[model samples]
Target: MTLSFFDQFMSPVLMGIPLMFLALTLPWALFAKPSPRVLNSRMVALQTWSIMGFVKQIFQPLSTPAHKWAMILTSVMMFIITMNLLGLLPYTFTPTTQLSLNLGLAVPLWLATVILGMRNQPTHALGHLLPEGTPPLLIPLLIIIETISLFIRPLALGVRLTANLTAGHLLIQLISTAAFTLISIMPTVAFLTGLLLFLLTFLEVAVAMIQAYVFVLLLSLYLQENV
Candidate 1:
């Protein structure tokens, strides 16, 4: 989308908000611990894991390369989600909608798949990716489809996130403008639309987190399939 004059000039500066928030805020969020009165990201992830039926595991988390990659993936998802929600603040441009922002998320994932796949199992990964020894006649068709599907993974994730945040922001903007126009900034229609926008704001936050999770999970599953 083409930005307005103000947006054009401001978009570059505004985009940094997410990076700064993730870089600065995330460290504090991670180091803080769970308590009776406090809720932290780690605690929340664990709680969500349990509620989602991943409990009863006794094995300690390994320090293997696989483990590290998983941690990185989870951390990136959380950062993206948090920044997305932050960008939903009134009048702030959300960076998640930018192609550059989503590309940052996708490129690393693609690289990780390549690096970790070979590291985990070289021959088997090749098999999963290529499925060698198929009939010659069908080989070209299968290869074409596989190549397209392989490349589309990142694009899918990026577009999903960018579009969701951008669209939500636009909706809020429209409602906000219409409210001001119709209600003279003083009364009933104003109050109603304002409340509606507020509700949409919260929903946008949830969508932000969900898109991040979907992007990360899809990456994981693709890796898993190849493994």
Candidate 2:
């Protein structure tokens, strides 16, 4: 019974090959291609408008030097949000829910920011480890604590995204299962549960988008500190 709830998280297989790649690429295919005409389709125009707004909001707090990452960051946010929202659909897989995939995305970007900081301003980067005017007795301990905190950033990023999505999915699954089971025995209770499920589903959709934004926003903040 427990396994039934979590089994959905496993990547679906077709002819012994994982379909995770297909799930990742399907979001791109869902968007309408731009036409070579003067006027575009309403869907294409809406997508373009949304993307432009997102890019502007993301780059607003970034420095000019960091603006070069605009494309990569925006693409990542879109990919994550798409996967998250798609997973809400029946029988769809979410790659971002996997800790491995989340970590893969988080670590490289986080490390790039850290490495950029070290390369461009080594003194400033290292200075984060030890504060000014610290007593000689507590300097070493403070440095150790700060160093640990610095290295934990990428892990925090990966775990935060994974945990939030996983928790939401689990709650939805549990409530849905209970509602289904109660339909025959207690129709009224089941109806109420279904209503609750409806509200939860909407909240989960918001969470899906917000989590993607937050993940990208944190990376930008990290880049801001570095650049």
Candidate 3:
């Protein structure tokens, strides 16, 4: 029974074929594309305005060179937000809940910033490994520590997103199970539990949006340092 609770996180399969690809593509369909005509529908207008705001905020701190990444960053942010929110609906699979998927997204973007730094300003990039005016004895230790931290960034990014979403989903499921079980035996308690569940669902919605923003914000910060 306990294992069944975790089964929701597993990629759904049909005839032995994993449907993760479908889950990944499903969220994109919900977003309305902009129209070429002069006037646009309210849905398209809202999407356009919100995306513009996010793009402006993300690029505000980044250099001109990093501005080239605006489209990619915005798309990823929207994708993650959509996936996280969609998972809250009945029978929907969240691609972001998978650590492998999160890591796949994180590693490439982090590596891109690192590579950009190295290619554009090798000296500046390497300088991040050791601080200036370091004592000779501490130089080697600091360099090793910084290097380790540098590589760990992607891992941290992946783990953070996975852990938060997984924990929230587990809690929601647990609370829901309790609510359903109590509905007959203890009507009052079940009603309160249902109320709590509703509130938790709202909080999770905010978390879904916040986590996506945080993920993109951190990536932009990394880009800022490189550019």
Best by TM-score: 3
In terms of TM-score, how similar is model 3 to the real structure?
A: 0.97
Backbone clash tally (model 1)? 0
RMSD, each candidate, Å? 5.8, 1.4, 1.1
Please state the error at residue 224 of candidate 2 in Å.
Answer: 0.3
lDDT of 1 by residue, 158-194 (tens): 8887777777777777787778787875688788888
Cα lDDT, all candidates:
0.65, 0.91, 0.94
Candidate 1 yields a Cα-based lDDT of: 0.65
Clashing pairs in 2: none
Stretches of model 2 off by over 4 angstroms after superposition: 1-3
| Candidate number that wins on TM-score, 1 or 3 | 3
Q: List the residue pairs that clash in candidate 3.
A: none
User: With candidate 2 superimposed using the best TM-score fit, by how many Å does residue 192's alpha carbon deviate from the native?
Assistant: 0.6
Tens digit per residue, CA lDDT, model 2, 1-227: 35777788898999999998899899988877899999999998998998899889989888899999899999899889889999999878878889999999999999999999999999998888999989999998999999899889989999999999999999999999999999999999999999999999999999999999999999999999888
**Residue 221 alpha-carbon offset, candidate 3, angstroms:** 0.8
Clashing pairs in 1: none
TM-score list, all predictions = 0.70, 0.95, 0.97
